[model samples]
Target: MQQFAGNSCSRQEMDELMQYVREAENDQLLHSALQQQWSSLQPEEPLYPVNWEGMYDTIVASPATENKVGLSPSPIPLIRRRWWAVAAILLVAAGGIWVWTKTPQQKTPPVIAAAKDIQPGSSGAVLTLADGSKVVLDSAANGNIATQANASITKRDGVISYGGKAPGVAANAPVGQPLMNTLTTPRGRQYKLVLPDGTTAWLNAASSIEYPVSFTGKERNVSVTGEVYFEVAAKSNAPFVVTTPQQQVTVLGTSFNMNAYTNESIARTTLLQGSVLVKIRNSQLKQSSYILEPGQQATGNAGGMLQVRDVHAEQFIAWTKGYFLFDHASVPDVMRQLERWYDIEVSYAGAVPQREFGGKLERNLPLSAVLKMLETSKVHCKVEGRHLTVLP
Candidate 1:
């Protein structure tokens, strides 16, 4: 039996044989071969045999065997042929580890060959006015654009801002025709804009913001689809409000971040300064509200349930500061952020093992480098042009 176990019985072949042994009926020839392999296993010290009684109990209780294999056979005489057969099978199964490691292993295929070339976020956006005019705001743009009512729209130092007062309009002007302004950044892009109402906003890559030309009436409101960092202007009389499909965040004056991307079901509102009230949509007449203090975050789901927790404000707002800081984040969450920034596709061949990764990666690093860092944790990744696939 030992002579028959030649080079032809590769690790792969042995694995298949062991799997077959688990399900197939026991025979004398197969049983003798397994016993020969098991007898060869010798530890440096006297190794006690495994507690098969306890192992058998666990196997019997397992859900997979509950409906199929049923309970273990009644304990038989120690010298019976059936008892020896079961012991040999268990011993052979335990020796599989030694065989696999002792044999030559196959070479794995390479995944990402080179790292992607990406730069730090910069000043970039595509602005569209109510008059159907498009303006690309970046470092190259010379000066301020046309003034709107009481504010002078200006671009300086790679940022867009509004100054001066409405020339002839009343202190409280009506919310004129809805004017849409969108701020977007590519993989290596970042931007900052000061709204007409003195509200300053910073945008991360692949993000956008839409707002009216001016705020009129009792409340100041804006709608966002992606991520944005807001340092809202203080106005006790006019509260600032941010609205998304899942919920709304209202504040008197505060600095916070709203991550309500369409692809993510959970809308997160992380407060950096002051306070804000998060209102979640529910079936009841009164929506659930959560008040957040500085260094707190309110995560609201589409189902209208909400949770408030403490978080590091700087880490939550790291994207606005030109970096992707992860503290034990999941692979899927990390990949989701990468997908939006790089504008690429991602898929997985098998289950992504649950791993907690902690590191601070510059946003400017190439996509390939990011994937390489992930591989350090035993996770493999393959990059085919713009598509990235994760494999176990």
Candidate 2:
């Protein structure tokens, strides 16, 4: 307790302390004892900068407490015991050792003084009309932004939707080529879209999706890059098909997330609510496919066969829900996620650390706040300008 109060506890010690706290939270006697202790101690704000909410949530969602509870969308319950837990965190951070060390294993370079802090990403995207025109949704007004051949493009509360007939144009007059519109979310931003067929898509940062303004053919087809989550509107007559660089996913009105970033070695399609058939698009390999059910994920590479595995599907779509979840993720994997969302460059000082990270953090946290958490896990790094350097 004294070491924790002085912020001198190591990561393992902190883990043990957190375990004890979790036990107390569930035990009537320990709960009363902790509450009495809280009353005797004076509340003091942490002198060192700390992501209080992130720290609190991480502790409560630790594996010892709730194995996969962190992935759920349910809000954390508020109670009196939680207050004392937060107060204990503040006390820990108030100690001098919370300032961090210069050691290789726990180095935390002063980010604010050394460089500008990168703010978290927000809702933004670019809408490319068929005529080669573009509208920046971040700055565009919340109303009808453009008019296509058979649909009116409208932006409402940050969501771009295609609906309604163009003025002076008959809805059934489209006897020509279907107009296509592409929605792209640059790094440091994301956007949601409603397709002409009523299908909704949530595009992650550095992602793009192209589809027609109106569904004309027997199949509703759209090609994508990077990651996108879809809640396909039920259309029994027309199947919804998504084309990626490495695979094609065909669905009949279901919810799924596709991670097909060109930089990633493998493309993953996680099924959440409905069934999806994942087919390898690589020509060299014999055309093979796998059908994914809810709670299953299909993973394939450019030159490999599709493989199915059971997974906590919620983890794959956590970005759409505003959380970053790392389940036994490597250093490179975690850095890749940060690189896209924070719009920063990453370079290592030596061989990459072989450690695996597991936990959840809010996507809205600043870069420095995230780095601070990483340092606690003994993954040291330094930030300069828009670049992040992983130290040995």
Candidate 3:
């Protein structure tokens, strides 16, 4: 018998073992495997280092009726059900422990053995060069990728930086006929960039930023497609402008965040430092433009007035800091962030329930770990392959 405990296995080996667990109707085989795995990983020893006792106490006795493996049995003595429940719990815990420690190789398609249906995103993106060539930034060698005329674009320490004189920096020479370069983060990936003007941009998953290799004209301008947090370089003569689908934001030597996902109703611009002018073009905005102060957020587009409200700045830019900050965020809102981060899709079987979440969760946790947290809130769900279905 292959022992998964303390022994690593390839994805295919894990698949065979998991299939055995799922299909084995023989109680003897199941008991042998369960006992062997359990003896190796002492459940009584504690799952977490410091909080083992707390977790142990939390694992209350499951009702006899709770047969997690879909076992059919007649109404028997109370003692049998209680013991069955304990066995089921130990089997599950041991299996999860084994699966948690194993990871598939990079090129192989990963499978979720026990709990996590999806894994967290990492630093990756696609860099489209000026000459219509595409470079997979995640796999590319980290160094000087390609030079664009006078400026050089280099990848170092997981960030792409632009070096060399821009339109009005260092040498006063004209940076003629600027070539455009765009950095895009596909679903389940993210990246950072330092523009030619020394401004830094952190792009969220499913987001992109396109700009000239060199700062041009009186005002440095760039266009964005999704969410991006920016630390604009201070250029009094050449202000920085970020143009999105529904609105445009103008800033000078400041930091801010813009969330303009096409599926979202409102396009929001939150200012964390300095000042910014948000111009809304949607019909929802009665007033077209408003100046945002630090710690203020401008919400509403064409159909509404540029409404400015106070917000926790960190919550808006938490993704840049490697965390999901959910302060009374709705379930749909939470799932949308998860969808992009894990590169999965979510759907509801019926009318979506109204749910709000408030807390800070690490983005690095496996999908199962995160979902287990959600179960406490009564958000029952299941992940089949890459799709997550919300249960009533």
Candidate 4:
């Protein structure tokens, strides 16, 4: 991907950075050296007699801050901080032998042409009409696509909307098949849908949601595979129900997120508003259900009791806002998400590294940038062709 670090740094920005370096007790001093070394001060940074020539000179000229530490002889000022820094300095000063061994292969640019192959996923999905006709939404010009007796299906602005005449018959007619359509997203895509009942759904990558073209009965029901976030429209007479292969979630016009990826062992339903009844379908014991309040989640497999827990709903919904939020998430778990959105395969050269990460990254960044950030956590990555290899 394109590695971009501006060549210019403003005076105020540089001063603020100098303050950060001075106040980090020199802990973040060398940590930030790479950036300081790579970036040049803008004409406005007051780089005069010494010309802001070297990062050391800049540090030497910087005013001592509250977190300043006393230091001795050192080429890189930061090596004077912790015991590890002392060892680093001793190794470097011993003959500078170890310095060359830890080369920066991780931050180097990827094969640009090959790197260009990995771009962010966009809004898209395959909308199947009641008759089994499919519409490639991204390629289909935004407008009306299909019309049924009770509703008209329209695609506009990456969203599919159902609007038309009122319901004629219940979608859950037990006598015959209901007229339903499926919205599906492949590995590298996601989509949004507005149900005939005015319920909104945000489908994540490699996910699908099947529902009637129009709600006819006493309840609005839909079945989801993979992951989907729902904003159910409240109808006092009709409760909304979402079913998955492993579990079923009943909600009363509340907003919630349901993650039922087939690859995962547990299906999780997180509620943001309104209460939800989570029922386990795989349980061999007595039929049981768990009522979840706002900011709560229910997770379990088909054969186990659904466990209720508290969670930060924002983290679960960040994907809908274009982010990859990981809270103590494993490397493989992160790779799985990356694989889905970047549309690439991931392989391991050695034993999988046991690491947990906590942070947030924009989903729109190129594969290389994400890998570069991952490398900081000691997870080395190399992208070639359409595959990414994680090295131990």
Candidate 5:
């Protein structure tokens, strides 16, 4: 079995083993043997890692005179549902290799079994008050979490809001240096906020937004790190301004998604509705600014010119909707997202796969299930604790 797993078996030996797997159901002796072997297996990990691609190629290349053997052809007739399970077990017991073909109904176990399974991230965040007090919102009951600057702070339906306006407060109300608060989400958490001016913001995992508890003077200004989606309330006199590490987006009333994580090479501001002006931070000498209409995006880097292009704006905000929508995204791009949401560290064992993925996956699935989905595209990985190492 170890020799077979290591691809040391002769062609004839491999062919006979595949044939045995294909016909294991009709042969009761083979079925019982496979079942006994599977049931007697211990919880210990496998001694040798299976070469999945090699084993699959060998099986498909075998000259089967009676039935076509590849997964795509599906020439062999499936006699019973239990037969598929038995055949998969037989393949694993014989060669330590198992391939999922067209059984969509069957639940796929993790590709690499671990002692503990990592769950998905949930809705949560930490709120830093103006006085430097921290409130863990997830564990707090869902109402009147705190009060700040004469504004009632409430958490309800997974959204934190600054309710109750300071009586007689006007857009041009005189204010001091302005009390600021920050809402931050950890790697394994997300959060939503309703700013004092009624603007809504959704913070993705490992992101944050710092804003005053109340809008004052001529404009409402905020700074953010990481990714955030916003629906700015319309106030002609008080334009909403969002400042990131690389750029600043100013709009009277607009919906947009901003991705400005420090690790990312480019800072992006994608506009969904209304108009926004994107300007490079401290680019006074160069003087760069771009006006983005709906369905347009502005991308720039530090000390670089801002570039605007058309895009499907909805795709950028899909994370706020509880799923990842990857449109021809590279492996590193996909893994970066997974790293934040699952709070897992990803490293490469060899050359990174120059592969692109396009699909929509739920954000609520376990890390293992998500990895299994990636395996369908031949992306393999080994998970140990909270670390996932991509394998070539």
Candidate 6:
């Protein structure tokens, strides 16, 4: 009797053996070959079997041929033993295929799910008056509140109204007094106010708007550090001026939006409804000025260089209308707007792709939904709590 060793049977050898068994027409010869292979197997050792249950069983159970030489009365046990061997062989083949085709599992970085649905222009900043007074204007509020000089300060229907009037003189009043006020908005808050000159201003989140009680000079100037939209009252004799870190905007009764956040290097002045003159610092001697007509924008860098270009007026003023409208804007630009509106932090984990996106976003939606929309256009974003990371 020839003995069969498990270790000596290579995959090629087993395949050849299976082919031989499949080709045998004599049942006695097939049974004798199988018994010899099985008897040689050590009791404590494992054996690999080929898969032949379906076709092999059908063939073994069929009527025998007339030329059967050493055929036995029963081949059921032989078929059963062969079935186990076939199963083992098939499992080994499957495992080899799996090993070759399987890919390594991907490792996903951790992400925070909070504030995943914050929309673009849903919230804004608030102004805390000098007397530790608070005024909520993101939504509707009640009746007339106070009067400042020539302005009637009223909080009716969720808006702060400042109707222009002449400054009243009180008996024995101090002359040339400066009544100071501070406008502050916490995270997830927003507010709007009408200045004494009938100019309308909207403040963004985590921002402040400081103004004097009255506009006394030939030029009315106000300073800001975050984002604000202004619709100046037309006063040709007294031009309205907006002062920021890099440049100043002078307008004669025009509407514009200014983004002058200290953390940002460039200050932007976008004209919406009128003309304005943009003057960069240190360029005063050269008299370098960019005159922006309606639907134009002037961008001033920290080095006092100004660039003027045409733009969509609606895109610039969309924040005041409770949305963010982007027309092929960059990733950093989009992130900056998100940080201000959501009052969150942003960091980049990988190289930021040089891609531009164009869309309009309502601030009332979830932050996750906003990021999902951005992802549809090759820009992937992940949120970790208040921190957002952009990936290329």
**Strongest candidate by lDDT:** 2
336-357 in candidate 6: lDDT tens per residue?
8788777688888776656554
TM-score of 6: 0.62
Judged by TM-score relative to the true structure, which candidate is superior, 2 or 4? 2
Give the number of colliding residue pairs in candidate 1: 5
Best by TM-score: 2
Q: Over 4 Å off in model 3, which ranges?
A: 1-116, 166-177, 282-286, 302-304
Once fitted onto the true fold, the runs of candidate 2 whose alpha carbons sit more than 4 angstroms away are 1-115, 165-176, 283-287
lDDT of 5 by residue, 1-392 (tens): 33333334554565576566666455676567556665654325553344444434333432221122222334445453354455444454442332322212213442443323689999999999877999999899988988775888999989998876663243454645667789999999999999999999999999999988878669999999999999999999999999998999999998999999987879999999999999988776454798999999999976778888898788899899998866657789889999999999999987786655544467887887677656644567888889999977
TM-score of every prediction relative to native:
0.65, 0.76, 0.69, 0.71, 0.70, 0.62
Q: Candidate 1 lDDT, tens digit per residue, 303-326?
A: 667888888778878887666766
The deviation in Å at residue 352 for candidate 1 is: 2.5
Tens-place lDDT digits, model 4, residues 186-300: 9889999999889999999999999987787777889999999999888989999899998989878799999999877688999999988999996776645798999898898
Per-model clash counts, in order, read 5, 0, 12, 2, 0, 28
TM-score of 3: 0.69
In model 1, which regions exceed 4 Å deviation?
1-121, 146-151, 167-180, 186-188, 282-287
Q: Of the pair 2 and 6, which is ahead by lDDT?
A: 2
RMSD of 4: 11.5
lDDT of 2 by residue, 128-244 (tens): 988799999999999999988657889999998887754323346466557778999999999999998889999999999998888867899999999999999999899999999
Q: Which stretches of model 6 miss by more than 4 angstroms?
A: 1-124, 131-141, 144-152, 163-175, 282-287
lDDT of each: 0.63, 0.75, 0.71, 0.68, 0.74, 0.60
lDDT of 3 by residue, 1-392 (tens): 24344234554564465455444364567677666756665645432232333222222221221232223433434534433443444534434311122222233332232444578999999989777898899998989988776788899989999888744233333445567889999999999999998999999999999999888788899999889999998989998999998788998899999998887878889999999999986654347798999999988755556778988787798899897866556778888999999999999866564555554567887788777655534455778888997765
Candidate 5, backbone clash total: 0
Which pairs clash in the backbone of model 2? none
